[model samples]
Target: MKFLDHPSRNLFFTGKGGVGKTSVACATAVKLADSGKKVLLVSTDPASNLDEVFDVSLENHPTPISAIPTLSAMNLDPEKSAAEYRERMVGPYRGLLPDAAIKSMEEQFSGSCTLEIAAFDEFSRLLGDPAVTAEFDHVIFDTAPTGHTLRLLTLPSAWDGFMSQNTTGTSCLGPLAGLQEQQKLYQQSVRALCDAATTTLVLVARTESSALREAARTSEELAELGVGNQHLVINGVFQAVDTTDPYAVALQQRGAAAIDEIPAGLNAFPQTTVPLCPGVILGIDSLRRLGTLDSAVATDVADESVSGDDELAPLSGLIDDLVAPGHGVILAMGKGGVGKTTVAAAVAVAIAQRGYDVHLSTTDPAAHLEAAMNDERLPNLSITRIDPAAETARYSEEVLSSAGANLDEQGKALLQEDLRSPCTEEIAVFRAFADAVAAGTNKFVVLDTAPTGHTVLLLVSALAYHREVTRQSSEMPEAVENLLPRLRDPDFTRVLIVTLAEATPVHEAAALQRDLRRAEIEPYAWVVNQVLSSLPLTDPLMKQRQKHEQQYLREVSQQQASRVAIIPWQLQPPTGIQGLSRLTHCDLSTSPS
Candidate 1:
């Protein structure tokens, strides 16, 4: 609420997944609109649920909503924009090329870089072009998860550097030589982003140490880029709503302590704290009310640790099914911000502590797996990351060389242009993923996946690309060739779907499950990370909110997965090795038979 005092026209909201970026952004936008300012709210996130939040469908262009006289909203579909950009880039050479060459070119454009570039292309037009801003009093951006947003912001420089070095030529990508007008726009966009006076960067985060540290890091990066006008919003700072509830008091104390550690650098900035709400933050009404944190829930903090002698409960039961001998892989899959990486890392730590040789790895673009394992002495656990930039670059170069080695200057130019599309990264990353997944046979392989949409696409593309590769050549690399079968083998892989108890994360996790089933990958367990109900409460309102979690918790238990595990809300935020290790309770393990 204090952020209103400064009143900047350009606002950005970014945080870890499920920290309520959308809710906060929406509420702020609504509040600004209520004050009679013309507002255009844009979501650059590929996984945006702005339509759901506002209870209306939104697309690439701005849509009028609320009849609020001056307020409008838009949900930018980066995929659609990327597809359009690809077509426009490749349209010129449609008929002159061989069908095989053309198909190869299209495949090259499908990389992750292409999508990023295309999204940036659209974003640049809106942010960099002064004409676009003439119609709005304020432009608010609800960004993707932190890692993706960082990549998105850093792309201009990445593309600029790449473009500066590469000469125009045809390689594996046929018919496309290089980027044309996009380079210029990207340069301008970079300038716009770095212009501190015009663009104000708002770092939205929870009271947790990791979130705060991320905010600090982002501040430093943006400042180095010359965008120093940064503000921090510490959201969901809670206090006990019930005086009598000891559990609520303890939980509130934990949250408060976390909030107390808000770095000194951010203290000087306009800081506003929203309270923990009692119910699901869905639809406009709920979103608008999120700014006014309701202290409606409280519950007694039950001792989260299970008795070592008592019959192993459902939580331990799920882990038992998973760590059972001969299950080649245990994959952690879920929407961003649901603690998949943490859960995956914890599982690896636990397994390795038990003497299982475990390969804990991640295909997440913003992988924190290495950080998660820092200083831990789990001799049996090792970590690997499928670095998208590295793998995608290698894949692109290989494809170009193999497919278009003999093309002439013009033909190669066209091929290069065709390959410039973003779909290419998806293919490349997926290939590396396939190779990595194949390693699960001899060890307990744990995979922390990308976000919901990207992960689903990754799985689907495996089958689809395998089919394509089979058509291309009989001598496909062993990694590409074996992708589908490895994924299809249930005995070789066990999927653990992770999610928060909230509506969006839970719904998204459920959707992810549906996608996995459609792809014939059965989930091994469902982990509801950071559950507060298991903790004690003292406030009446906090107790009410905890009570409300019963329905969703029940739903998660009954409908989300046949087997489930609950991690109690910790009194301290999870960060670094010490914090992450605290998650692995020895009592959570089943006794050896």
Candidate 2:
């Protein structure tokens, strides 16, 4: 509510995934509109949850929300924008180019780099072009961009360097000559971001070490980009009103300690805290009540629930199904903050317990794959991270040696500058992802992929990965050149889509499934993480939340996913091998105390 004290035309809420950016943005927009201001609430997340939060469907264009007066909202579909961008770039070549040439161009446009570039182009126009948003008094953005991507798009130096180069016929977004017209507009946008009077940036995070650290990094990066006016919103803060319940006490203490030991970088910013609530924040009424929930009395208790263990299948049911293949690739992917890393680690541990060799890895920037599982001592399982810093260094050296060896001073300087672009990191990380996939040929490779919004659309992302593999190695490695075919082959790959038992996560996971199917990859199963129905909680709010989860459980089993596995929320997060194995019911596991 304090964020409303000083209003700016543009408000940006950004942080690591699942930090309540969407909820906070929606609530702020509703409040501002209630105060009689014309507002446009926009979500640039590829996996937008505005529709779930507002209870009204929204697309790329503004749709008036019936529940809120003077407010309009839109969910920018980056995949759609990327598709349109590809058509515009390749449409002119129809009939003039051979079938193979046309296909190649299309594949290039389908790369993750194309998604990032096309997304930024749309983002710039939305912020830069005055005519496009002249109707609204304030524009609030719930952006799903990573810190790396944000730097590439908003930093003045990044654009300046790109403009100075002869980048035609080089990257995913087409010839550099085509981007000339947007330079001035981009510059204006950068100026607007830097102007404290016009824009306010809010960094959202959870009261957890990892989340706070990410917030700190983002805060530092954005400040360097000239967006100096910033506020920090630490969401999901819990306080144990029920001292008798050890679970509640432990939970509160953990959060309190995280706040007590705040990230150093965040110390400079003003901070606001939002209370943790069991009930999902959806609809106008819930949005208004967010962060205002009254503390539960120590004696408050409510018991109302419904479940059949056989009906609501546990994650253990799939052990045999998953291990049956003996060896292949198992990819765990979903929206941010959905516990994909935990689930992936659990599955790997479960499979490896069966005496098969497994390689566990991740492409996520928040590399918690190791932190999620405790027992790395298992000889059957090995873990690795495709770290951005190390990959960027290796990639930069390779590019400088091969691409810049013969360049003059100007060309060499430009090439070096280009290598520093955040997009370069995306490329380097992507190459590493490909290398990890290749490892699946010999053993069970468990991949904890990045969250949906920051990663490329699953539908087209696997395109020409095989061709790229061949290009990377003269004597191509043993890995399959065509990643999709291998993935499509039931004998070679399986994907487990992880999501929460909530409206937003369920809908997003459904969308993920649609995209994966389009890529000819079928999800072997869906893991619905964090179900309150499976636990015993003597709390009124928790009981209400349990009621809400049943609807999603039915939705998941009956409609959203063809095959499913459900993991109950633990009193504590499953952080180590023992905790993780419990989720999968692996042989080495013991039940959580």
Candidate 3:
């Protein structure tokens, strides 16, 4: 593959969740190291499974991989970085500040965004500072999931805007007293990212429409920022292992169809395809085995079917619980790429098929729900999308008119500046989401909420208005006033924590469940989406993968709430109404467990 052609320096791998970016990136790094080049593999993902993959623990500092002489790896520890960032921010005032004051400062910087920015700060330091890369022939970065990555990559302008405003105030992000120099470095780092010679952007996609579409969107956005030296690696490309294998034939057919419809917009980029591997691409051995894929497609596919009453039982049970008479709201809230939209659509279809009036909506700014529907005809379910840009624009106008109309030019500039933060978009979208959730009182409402970190921040921000109300003694806006009350009523809302039968997704999902409980929103059930055990497989390679999947399956069954659902792997794409119907009634138990 072209992305692997360079065994040294400047490799960037990115993709949607579950598309094998980590595996592919690791394999490339391993290949380079085995070729006698010193390779440094780093993961900026908060839920990185690098330790599991290498079968060794890693800290922020690079640890030798042991499997290869020249390869080393590190996982950027967000919590530890956040702590260091806080210490640095408040260090100068150590003698002047009280212990309680310092504690408060640390608490203020303890939010999810602070952790994210701190991680980004470390990444920029490593990537932009040549000193860090001096000892390595190659630096491979396995980025966080898509949404978080997009935000991280765009931080240069975000920090620059904050610096230009120079607002002096007590804020939610603690004392911003030490930001000036950091902001300058941040801008420089962003420039470095966009410089094609210094950076290469790789978009990883599966042979699925949604993944491809997301890649196209990512390419366009990144290109606009001048990060145009890009390559497309289509992972999980399927080819029939045997002509007589009907299941494998069906998978190849479906995969080919999806690739045929690859968005014409992404045609400009250099592209490579990876062939399907019959087994899970975990551990250095498996990755190296994949690296010898000469004249091989970069695609790796899993279309296996598993047999067990347990596999099909979970989905049926979840359906029964959701089939009550009175209408209520169902929110599929969990980590990104955990199949929330898929589960939400399936549940909405399941309930609507039972004759309930259902309205399925998504607050994801990316608009994955519309594509999930696939122009399929639905009998009773109505799909609605809350556009973040639209909501933010309207909310910004309202806030400016009501609060900053009389301000001078400098003050107005600050007002516009504060409004530009992505946090403003979150607040605006949360209000719209609240309005949509409130609409569920008389009919069934299903929401595919923003991912875990974003959702938690949104809910926490809802409580901010209450704090603002008590401090100002002013009546709050109608939208802000109604949010907290509506969300807190468990009877009115049921949250489904969706996850994949995989280590990273399930671990992140568990954390999400805890966060939701902290916010007083208990998840109704855990839906383990896309399990190989639900699908039957005759291939030995696929059978080996099933064994690997067992560990994660066990984790999901043990970690989630008592109520759980499992959707089997489908050979065909889960697009349109008929496909969704299969997911609605996913009962795969004919094969051996």
Task: Point to the candidate with the largest TM-score.
Answer: 3
Q: Give the per-residue lDDT of model 3 (tens digit) for 1-593.
A: 67666422677788877777888888888888988999899997767888988899998889998879899999987767877998898777777989877665655565455666777678778777778778998788897323443354354334444534443342334345555457656566667677777777888888877788888888887776667778898887777655565566777887788799998878888888887665566777788776345323323445543433264355656776676746778888766566788788878888888888899989876777777779674778899889888988987888778667777787676667656656567666766777787787789989997435434544465443343221112236564566556666777777888887766677778767776767777777788777776555665445555656777777666646666677777766677777787887656652332
Give all TM-scores, in the order shown.
Answer: 0.74, 0.86, 0.86
Cα lDDT tens digits, model 2, 372-444, are 8754558888998888889888978887777678778977776676677676676567667767777777888
Weakest 10 consecutive residues, lDDT, candidate 2?
Answer: 468-477
Q: How close is candidate 3 to the true structure, as a TM-score?
A: 0.86
lDDT, residue 89, candidate 2: 74
lDDT of 2: 0.73
What ordering of candidates by lDDT runs from best to worst?
2, 3, 1
* Better-scoring candidate (TM-score), 1 or 3: 3
What is the C-alpha local distance difference test score of each model?
A: 0.65, 0.73, 0.70
- What ranking of all candidate models by TM-score puts the best one first? 3, 2, 1
RMSD (Å) of each candidate, 1 decimal: 6.7, 4.0, 4.3
State which candidate has the highest lDDT. 2
What tens digits encode model 1's per-residue C-alpha lDDT throughout 455-568? Answer: 445446643344333322234678666665776677777777888767667766776787677656777778887665544444555555555566666777777777777765
